[model samples]
Target: MNETVLYEKAGAVARVTMNRPRVHNAQSRVLLEGLDEAFAEAMADHDVRAVVLFGAGPHWSSGHDIGTPEELADRDARPYRPGADGHHQRSWDWNVENTMRWRDLPKPTLAAVHGMCIYGGWMIASAMDLIVAADNAQFLPFLFQYQSTPWDIGARRAKDIMWEQGLLTAEDAHRLGFVSQVCTPADLDEVAMAKAHRIAALNPLLAQMIKRQVNDAQDAMGFRTAIAAGHSAYMIANLGHAFFDAENPFGSRKKMPGIDEARERAERTK
Candidate 1:
């Protein structure tokens, strides 16, 4: 099978690139597993102090590959069968548990994003320690349909994004504190790698402690609890979509106008 993720070491920094460029690095079962393995590998490597996650394509990610039935079947056969505990539990596992694992990693992680970062893409980026976006990047929080919004970009902004089907420019994301920095498209890699190297140069133990302290502070404020609450609501929303709004099942069906269409419609109304 073709590799869905590529891993490389540069000095103390480990780079993990989502490799399915043809599909804009959409997360299929293999791709998700590949990411898990890549993260694990980076964590295990003593030489690695920081990790950079990005996509090897024009776009960062198109989000989850819901249309790939073969990949879905292959994923179900894997040990982490997300659906093993039923659909709701499965959502928690895939969307919450797995992402949290990466979020709580001991070392710092940076996401270098450009082009389209949608739905699941936003989920992964939000879990990272920092996000560096290319000037041309646009973020779509389409997971609003799944009821996961407020925590990533704050409450009032989330409402606007979801209600209007808005696309956030890199500048807007930076102002909202979702993106740490924004660089020109041509300089994205250089800027992100420089930040990674700077972090890698720090004492790994101290770096980890710093990360833990910040995460702990957030957790103390019920960040995790809020996410869990969102997941519960997400489960209900998903069931409604699956049964009643078949045309827009998880925002993946072609029968639906999709985010691009929704964005246009929202624009016209304005």
Candidate 2:
């Protein structure tokens, strides 16, 4: 729908590619809107039985486009009232509502992840019905934003991941049941497309029903509720960042000393 995202259909499989390679396909508001439109188009096409989402670069996504002032300003200029609270609420709504919408899409969806799948990117991958990660892919919740690690990867492992600020290799993700499969970078696209096509070959109605059943099982375990609660916590955390972390108020408080420093601190504590 937009230059930020590309959509194509091959048989019953629809592919949505995030196209901002230079910025590691960072999630700017424009990019997010484009993604929504692409997914909506695929969902509305009756011929499309499955969807594949991936980035068109060395990395899937680094995270949100926090450093782009022009993009941020454009996003802020939207109908929303301008202020810290307004910004926080808007972000919370967008991230939670859109992700949940994608998660519940009737057709099965697969995410092909590689390189940096961190922060908001992690949330995107977690929402997909299945994930096919390149061997070089690394999953990091990047804890500087909303935390969905527990719901996505289970409680104990989530704790271990956050405690260590861990970079989860594809094999580690598969072992933890977070990734459906892992492939070499060169084979990632083929592997993901094959899986999508295979799933598409199944009775589409039954496939949708099966996906709903599994999601319902997860909901029964309070998965959706937990994510909502995390969103609330994320808001509170932002308030802290705005009030206490004055230097970068309205931004991630975890910004200081950078990710490397944070990881080193985590390793030392471990």
Candidate 3:
């Protein structure tokens, strides 16, 4: 694959690394497309029974590309997805369609996230079956894209994130049952790889069945319906005046809370 994404295999597990350190692995259309190809590669390989996603450089991801030069170039020159027309289809293709496809992959998937796991980063990690974050990771898991707030961390906490623009610490995420485990940055990969191998070693059929069972339970609770509704709202926001708040009377939003505090706390403790 292109340098935007690196794919490798170790025994029974496949590792997919997002490779844009300069931009903190921002989710350019090319990068996301490459990631999907890498995941498909792992799934096609019989020897690969599990997958682990990682990001290159200091941060896992800064979030979706906010008009980066590279991203703009791709939009001008390359096709995002074949036959993906209009805002709705394109948004559904990347944000919902591809996301759920990976989520439903028969093999188990894990994401080892570190640094800034912001909105889009959180969305990517949420697609995986298990998320093992570094203790120093900071999460801004807001209701965006897939709109996985309630399913990932419950409705009340999701509201707290929106109301206060909350930043999520690794400890807080673990306590809220969002992150499956938290480890030091030094041990993050090892811990995630171990989990991948352990799952890979299990009976493959049983593993797939277990995944389906849990996901089915969530779907029964209207997980997919809620996500669809959220996506519709997000598209509407894109169309008209959105993100306007009474507190920001200057036509510009104020700085978010918990950014400095969360970084300092994670740094000092680490």
User: What TM-score would every model get versus the actual structure?
Assistant: 0.88, 0.90, 0.88
Give the runs in model 1 whose Cα sits over 4 Å from its true position: 73-85, 144-148, 242-259, 262-266
Give the number of colliding residue pairs in candidate 3: 0
**Pairs clashing in candidate 3?**
none
In terms of TM-score, which candidate is strongest? 2
In model 3, the Cα lDDT at residue 225 comes to 92
Clashing residue pairs in candidate 1 are: none
TM-score: the better of candidates 2 and 3:
2
Per-residue C-alpha lDDT of model 1 across residues 1-270, encoded as one tens digit per residue: 239999999999999999988877877768877888999999999999999999988889877776666556874575452332465665666668878888899999999999888778888888889999999898877542233357667899997886677788899999988999999999999999999999999999999999999999988988888777777766665666533356544334343234466458547646
Q: Which regions of candidate 2 fall more than 4 Å away from where they truly are?
A: 144-146, 242-244, 251-270
- Pairs in steric clash, model 2: none
Q: Residue-wise lDDT of candidate 3 within 1-270, one digit each (tens)?
A: 678999999999999999999888888888889998999899889999999999999999877775678986876695444431464676788778988888899899999999888877888989999999999887876546798977888888898775565578889899998899999999999999999999999999999999999999999989899989998887666443464344542223233323355455445544
- Roughly what TM-score does model 2 have, to 2 decimal places? 0.90
Residue 223 of candidate 1: its Cα lDDT? Answer: 81
| Cand. 3 Cα-lDDT | 0.83
- Specify the poorest-scoring 10-residue window by lDDT in model 2: 253-262
